[model samples]
Target: MKTDPKQTLYGMSVQELQEAVKAIGLPAFRGVQLGDWIYKKNVLEWTEIKNFSKADIEKLAANYDLRSLDGSEASFSKGLESTKGLFKARDGHFLESVLISQRDRQTVCLSTQMGCKMACSFCASGKAKFLRNLTAGEIVEQVAWIQRKTEKRISNIVFMGMGEPLDNFDATMKAIEILIADWGFQLGGRRVTVSTSGITPKIIEFVERVDGRVRLSVSLHSSKPDVRDELMPINRRYNIDNLIQTLTEVHSKLKREITFEYTLIENINDSEEEARGVVKISLPLNAKVNLIPYNPIREMAAVYKTPSKERIERFTKILMDAGIHVTLRKTAGREIDAACGQLRLDREAVSAAGEPRTKNHEPREPAS
Candidate 1:
């Protein structure tokens, strides 16, 4: 088997890191030191490994190269203080990552896959269909690239950017292990969140693997099967009831609060009745509802619209009145086409047109 040298620092367990050092003819103890530099110090170049002998450092560099993203193009949110980088992978594939600077910490949302297969009606990621699953190194490199450019430590990471995380379970979990491992990123488990679109078997697998360490966010758009099937095609395969059952099982086994991401769309699934249904579904579980007003996309305009502010308030009131914890996530980067896949699509159009293409700021219809 050809060993993957670019094994993501975000995906390796401590023992795995030790194994990597051993492969390079270094003492196992060197894994701990390397881990400290990778995670704690956040170093990339082998020369940064201060304790390693010059010959050993040169050997390590020659044998293995750390995966890092080279930002080909970038767009920043002048209004919200966030930047999205269009990174060119070594393989010439393009992936996107966002760095959002908030009051205290800067968080980078990383993509686990190049394109998405889920085909959520409101999301822009799957517009090009599923391309490929990102390697653990590619996923981690998004963070490293953004960190290097901004010179800010990423306080949190969300697997909500592109691809269904649970669909890429092994790489996803390995990335989480790297983030939390002492030899890796050394981040607290709670600071990392993995979002999935109701992949039940993987939820069970996650429960078995994580054991209440990392957080989970499930995209629960609508409680009705018909509505969900129309919005998210994945619902047709997994359905809502089975998904809820699996979430319940995972919660029971792990004893953690899972977040339910409810993207409210106008006239489709944002009624008081639906809000009531949301409460009924969530009342039984230890979960919080994150209500995101639909991020309007030009391609998806005919299919979806944001509910009136009054309607959103009414919907939120229903959840809060029902005593269910809820939050209305303010849509960030409205100035730029900040939706997950918008940046790359614009870049593609520009390249194809062979000119500077103007961005359509007006929200368009969602993909069907």
Candidate 2:
């Protein structure tokens, strides 16, 4: 068995930081100083800390590596103003993060895993092979990198990028801790949303663990069991009925609104019947349905087309008439292949073909 390398200092909790300081023959107070520099100050390099002596700084640098995003591979959406950043992990695997700016709100979408295992037919993230789970530090670094680069406070965070967040349970929760900690990013729990593809057991565990402090969203593309099973493979294990039941229990216990992400894939799950099903499921759980018109992927574009505006309106009207709260999400960042896993796939393809990586802003084809 091969031993893993030491953990990065960026993502450790304050308590963990204290332990790290103890290991280095430093006073426990030094850990708090380290936490402040890394989390609150968002310093990417060890040398940025001024409180530590030069010898202490050098000693710290020897034991830990500062992992941050590669600015060279970052891409910005032309009209939308959304930015997609590619961070190369220490192991040389690349992960992607997106900074989405809409008017006053600045939201950063973070990936919990290098690639996704959930084979959602509509998502490009699942098209690539599942690589490995990102550690807590790696996840936190995504937000820190965006904050440092754009100089904008991230108002909201959504685990809606490249992977199923619930699948990477520990790291995701630990990252949340760093985000919500006073000495860290200091974001409110409500500002952070963890979206999952109906991971039943994990959802229950999340509710129990977090006590519904953070916001939750379910990727419920289709309400019909057969259609859902076809679109999201995880639905087979945690079916729609059970998922709804779990969410309903959570809503009753917490009295909070849950978000149901419904991706309208042309005629597939856009039918009025599916809309009715969405209303049925949402009403019971005090959930609001977010209607997303599908972003056409190159591989699945021939099979699936974005639903016409008319179709989307009709579906929204049906849900609204049924006394369900619904919002039609405007698709953004499509011009830059802003969909999850697309930028990584493009880079991988270019590397495999022995072509120089293009840094031009021209959008590759959409994924998801």
Candidate 3:
């Protein structure tokens, strides 16, 4: 297919890749073959795509990049369970994708963009300067990158890493499509969750586009509109009312109950009123609240501490008493700067300073 010479083919679905190759005069079946090579075989090079002539591969290469592990690096935590991968895009900027392994699940959280512009004060990724939204291929390749690290197949995919998944709407949705397609990653929609910081319209649009296959997680740090406004600037724009209304309307199409991810920052949002407010949000949409003990980013450490266990318990009790399902998320990967965008930030800082960030396998210091 006549494509942007700069475009990457790694993330395309069998249908799209077929069209791309067919557009360029390749046999239609080559798309299926390419899909097998990329998704099934996890091929890193076009040369690895056999049966096609070297010249034919070169022709395909002119219009697209294979986007293997090249120009990328990773840092693993001490146990080898958690890994933070930094993939350098064609533009030379790096983006983050994390592997968080616990119990039976090897979940890989993907970044939809290079850096983020969401500006959530408590999050490392949101604090970053916005670069650009990653292409669908770039987004999907994050999984393939993490997949190469371990033998266990990834159990889940979360758009909970660096950027606001909703903000990069098209690429995020396309990536999800590629991930869930049998010709691609073949992951069930239930295993993929797209977390948004309350972008109401996109929420509805995403619901319709995915048709309730993938899970939807909303970051409801505080149920109070005013407090949420302060915590997530996005709330100021979408607000609580708009979000609830949108989700309620979209409820008819959702395949699974929604999950509201609550970051429990000490004193900041752990009040009894906040817990009740979470109940209010959860009950209407048949949602469950996942209480996250806020992982403090060093830059915001003094202001945003994880609440004490007592306070977390008290908060969880409120939801439990209300019969609203909730789970307290365990903190992970502190040593490797497992917080979203922390590694990319460190990688860029070290590169800018002309030094290495850390010795291999050892966790590096997070941003100050």
The numbered model that scores best in TM-score is 2
Q: What TM-score does structure 3 among the candidates reach?
A: 0.92
The parts of candidate 2 lying over 4 Å away from their true place are 1-4, 68-72, 357-359, 362-368
Order of the predicted models by TM-score, top scorer first: 2, 3, 1
Tell me how far the alpha carbon of residue 175 in candidate 1 is from the true structure, in angstroms, after superposition: 0.4
TM-score for each candidate, following the candidate numbering: 0.89, 0.94, 0.92
lDDT of 3 by residue, 152-183 (tens): 58989999988999999988988888888889
- Per-residue lDDT of candidate 1, residues 1-368 (tens digit): 86554544434566876888799889999877776776677676666678989997876677666445544355667765787767776554577878888898788888898779999988989785677888786787677767776778888998888788888888888888787766677778888888989888888888889988888899999999999998899999999999988887667776668899999999999998999999989999958999999888888879888889999999999999889999897777656777888776666565556677555442222111
Model 2 C-alpha lDDT per residue in residues 90-146, reported as the tens digit of each score: 665678888989898999999999889998887889888899998889899888888
Model 1's lDDT to the true fold?
0.79
lDDT of 2: 0.84
Question: What are the runs in model 3 whose C-alpha is more than 4 Å off?
Answer: 1-5, 23-25, 358-368
Q: In model 1, where is the ten-residue run with the lowest total lDDT?
A: 359-368
